[model samples]
Target: MARIDTNVKSIRYPVPCDEKLTLLARKLKRTKRQLFIEMVDYFYRSKKDPADMNDEMLKSDLSRIGNRLVGFFRTQESELLVPIHGMAQELVGNTETVKDELKSIHEKQGDAEKLLRENTKHASEQIRLLTSIFDGLAKMEEMRAGFRRIMEGYIAEREALGWSTSSGKKDELVRRFRLKVDRL
Candidate 1:
């Protein structure tokens, strides 16, 4: 085995450690004296030389550190209401614009479905009319699927933040939103 060098002499403590220190020493698998020596050495070494640190490097380090900290916090078992609140704040701000666009989509979907139904019922004798009706139906289905996707995304985001739709209020809101979209 290689020999380790010790430049400093060990000092003895006259009294026993307090409960916290004793527990810490046991947890760390080291005597209190050894821990103290290591800490003293670390402090002396840190004070001996100052590393060349710059703002850009410090910022990059902080960004990485912040990312790790956020990731760890996100893994913890906790209520997501706070995070959902932030998301709701963001989405709520854009609600008016989204609602306007949804209204236009709803109107277009309604028109397509109505045209398909009318053409299918009254123009069966014309092949071109039949084809157009089928095409309109397909388009309406696509639009409905798109609307469903949008709702799914909203619900998924909310769920990820720990919001459940089991409540009567949330269920009613979901039903109303879907009804409004389907009415188009």
Candidate 2:
């Protein structure tokens, strides 16, 4: 009796005598079963009729797909890439403007700080000069007070002794004045 193999099943299909299917399978480095499965899947996925796919039809289909890809790229470039490029340029320009403004502000700040320092220095010098002038004036006032007091004391002493404080002769006063003027 012949043994039955439970793990295998078989079906038969007819083909032309030229063996084109076998040749295509060998050229594509796939088994006949794998080739048939792939072909069936491709037809199902693409929804294309194999009977309509001659060389000219294939070329026309590829050209149409190529034109669609080109259009999609052009749309994306116009809608996305071109605007992004313009925005990038505008951003760079804004950055440069901000930098220039910052630099100008920094320079102005430095100048203002320098001017404040110079003004402070000038104010301090003026304060010192005023202080010196006030000190000199205070000393001169003290000296004038002292001289007035001494002159009053001398006049009182001379009056108590019944003598004239300004008893110098006219000739003596004139000689004294002439001597002082000569010294000057």
Model 2 residue runs over 4 Å out of place are: 1-71, 164-184
RMSD of each: 38.8, 8.2
lDDT of the candidates, in the order given: 0.75, 0.79
- Summarize candidate 2's per-residue lDDT along 1-184 as a digit string, tens digits: 9999774755566776227889999999998878888999998887777877465656889999999999999999999999999999999999999999999999999999999999999999999999999999998897677666655765565556453435554445446545644443
lDDT computed for candidate 2: 0.79
Candidate 1 per-residue lDDT, tens place, 1-184, comes to 9888865675555454456667888899999777777867975765533244544655777899999998878765245767778888989879978999999999999999999999886776587778989999999998889788768866775575466545776666667667757766
Top of the candidates by lDDT:
2
Candidate 2: the clashing residue pairs are none
**What's the C-alpha lDDT at position 169 in model 2?**
49
Kindly give the stretch of ten consecutive residues in candidate 1 with the minimal lDDT sum.
Answer: 46-55
Best by TM-score: 2
lDDT of 1 at 73: 80
